[model samples]
Target: MIQDVLVLGSGSAGLIAAVSLKIKIPRLNVRIVRDPALGVIGVGEGTTPNFVGHLFDYLRISRRHFYELAEPTWKLGIRFEWGPRGRFDYTFSPQMDLQWGDLPRPNGYFCDDEFSNVDLPAALMREGKAFARQANGAPDIQPWHAFHMENEKLVSTLEKVAMEAGVEIVDGKVTGAERAEAGIAAVMLEDGRRLEADFFVDASGFRSELLGKALEEPFDSFGKTLFCDRAVVGGWERGEEPILPYTTAQTMDAGWCWQIEHERHINRGYVYCSELTSDDEAVEEFRRKNPKVPESPRVVKFRSGCYRRMWVDNVVAIGNSGGFVEPLEATALMVVCGHTRTMVDFLLQTELEPTPSMIALYNEQASKNWHEIRDFLGLHYQLNTVEQTPFWKRCREETDLSGIQDLLEFYRENGPTGFCRYRMPSNLSDFGVEGYLVMLVGNKAPHNKPHRVTPEEKAIWERHRTANIAKAKQGIDVKESLYYVRHPGWQWNDEIQAKRG
Candidate 1:
């Protein structure tokens, strides 16, 4: 039976794994082993709606408290300087099924030109606003949108909650581990201490200390499909610029640069293929684009893929230990929360030595999730036409379109209308028809024999665009709206006005 659990590494992944496990099980004795000397990578600045749902519903953390401490500005979506048009906004809201009144097709068919202003959130982002304004003149928050936060604040906040809930935080490094017949029996710290647990959660970032180094698990790489292996990450404090409620992904010489907004600061990073451009050259390109960045970019090299199996014997790897992809969609925490949720569910159903079938099912689920992300990200690079550098050209010609090939083919055959009707497995494919449609339409992927919309349909699309733009004008900026929500006397009584999350 699984009683005691030890989570190694104390980043966001480790804390989340520890707390969520304890929260779900309630009976599991959980403790975290961490080395405080390892400084935090305070660059993760974006998340998906799944993370927000996890925050409010699953984790039960206070929404108000999150804003007050995390220095987060809401993110409606990402503005992509990608594709042939060289600019489009990928909002959190649905674009695929968003049809006009008595229209033959969804609005996406008409979004080929005005893609940025196609959605309500996209319109708000174009206007440099956070949310649509309610009649109360307050900035509204949408459930569809997510947050862009400072990484240090998030990890520290989670650590506090986990510790408060009885997770013993041990400060030390795991120097070694004791192996057993089935899996790891215990871990040895640098302080010459041995700690034992019925099960181990390896949240050890990229090191994969327990699962990779100790267990020597075979890795399943997606290098052929996802080629970004390095990031030159750096940012500057906010200035007179408006705090956007969306992240900006501008095409770079080698790969792409992400502009993430925080309340007091702006974080940016350039993820590039090391083989196409040297670290120094990527740094030069990054600094050239973002001259305000006060320092040289720090190079972080990472392989893009996951383990053969996330759960092996008595050890389960979570976060970067299990797998890592580029921060293209900010899927790091998604995997963390996802794996933790599944692991907790499994433990609740079975014991430490879960049968081989149970393990296979878990591994298959995790692998599918990882592959889905890999393929989705691949779609982004494969269709991007804004840049024609050696790296991007190679990506376009070489990257494999795994899993989503059928969907792409369907669109190629029938255009962007029938995507919602396309059936897909529930293997944790985070991006639904909407997500895929946004990227596909945003990139202007051609549908053969395109049906021409009459002037009437065009007028309807234009009317919707005008209405969205006008509504966005009433919305407030990220800075002002967050303050309004955080005011000690703030209150909400609206389904009429925009909402808050």
Candidate 2:
């Protein structure tokens, strides 16, 4: 049985793994090693509902405490400033995929001319609202909403949680790994100290020390599908900004830029291909677009790929050590939470003695998750209508859609029908059919079949949209919602908390 687990690196991924393992299985010993010299890549990060569930429900962390420390802003969805329509909202809640009781078909069919305000969340996104206002003037929070967090605050909160959960912290820089037949027997520290564990977790960011370097796991690159690699990251403090409730993904000459909103800051990063545009050129373009940034932004390089197997023998790789796609969908932390939860589940089910078959299954699931994300992100590039630039032209012409060809074909013929869900893979991503429909329909992708809505059905859809628009108009902004939640006399709804947990 695995009694002790040593995690290398103290980034968000490492700390999450340590805290999860220690909290879920109190009998096991979890220790995380870190080098004080290595600082985290502090930037703004956006998350999906999966992360919220993992933090508050699966791990049962106190929401109030997390809010106090992390100070995350709520994100209803993403506002994409791309494609033919100029922009569209992709909310966490289902809008296009939904079929109202009074409507004849799914909402996507009627969204040909006007796509906004299809649902409450999308409406809220359009109006720059975080949540709908209740009768008593409090924010009526829903499960579909997510968070936009500053990485430094999030890491510090996770470290605190890890320590409180009895996870030991060891300060050391790993120099080498002592290889064993099963996996790594021990890791050598720079100070000549050796650390041993029954199991190991590698969360060493892009370095991938344990799984990639030490174990020599083969990497499967997504170069064909994902081209943009370098990101110029910088931001500025907020002054009169309204603290918008969604991340903005705007199209650029070479690639795209993300605007992650924070309470007191607005973080921006331009992700572009180094080959297409030089670092200096990209920086110029970024500054031209966002002049509020006072200083030069630093360029961070990365590759898009995944290891052959996340779980090889006794060492399980999590986060960037396992794989990483771009932050187009803001899935880094979501992936971390998922990997940690799965590892904990496997250990618990097997009583800390996971069989070879169980490890194989885990690796299979991990690989599938990576591929699904790659395919979904590929769809974003494949269907984007911004075909003016050379880089975008290449993306539209050459992006690999082999994995999602069937889904695309169906949507092209059937126009975002819910039936496409039946044709999807058994292990579909968390995005589900709704995500694909939103991307396709939002981009106004061409379709052979078009639904001709009758007068009655059109009227019904109009009524629904109008109601959502009214409610969203009356909704609370992030600043207002924060005031209510942070008030000393205010209390979170017990029923909602119980449901989430």
Candidates' lDDT values, in order? 0.84, 0.90
Off by over 4 Å in 1: 351-353, 420-427, 491-501
Model 1 per-residue lDDT tens digits across residues 42-111: 6566998878878777877667666666767788888898888878888888766577667777777777
The regions of model 2 sitting more than 4 angstroms off are 494-501
Highest-scoring model, lDDT: 2
Q: Report the Cα lDDT for residue 423, model 1.
A: 41
Clashes of each: 0, 0
Instruction: State the lDDT at 190 in candidate 1.
Output: 87
Root-mean-square deviation per candidate: 2.8, 1.7
lDDT of 2 by residue, 314-334 (tens): 998888889999999998888
Query: In model 2, which residue pairs have backbone atoms overlapping below 3 Å?
Result: none
**TM-score of every candidate:** 0.95, 0.98
Tell how far residue 293 is off in model 1, in angstroms: 1.2
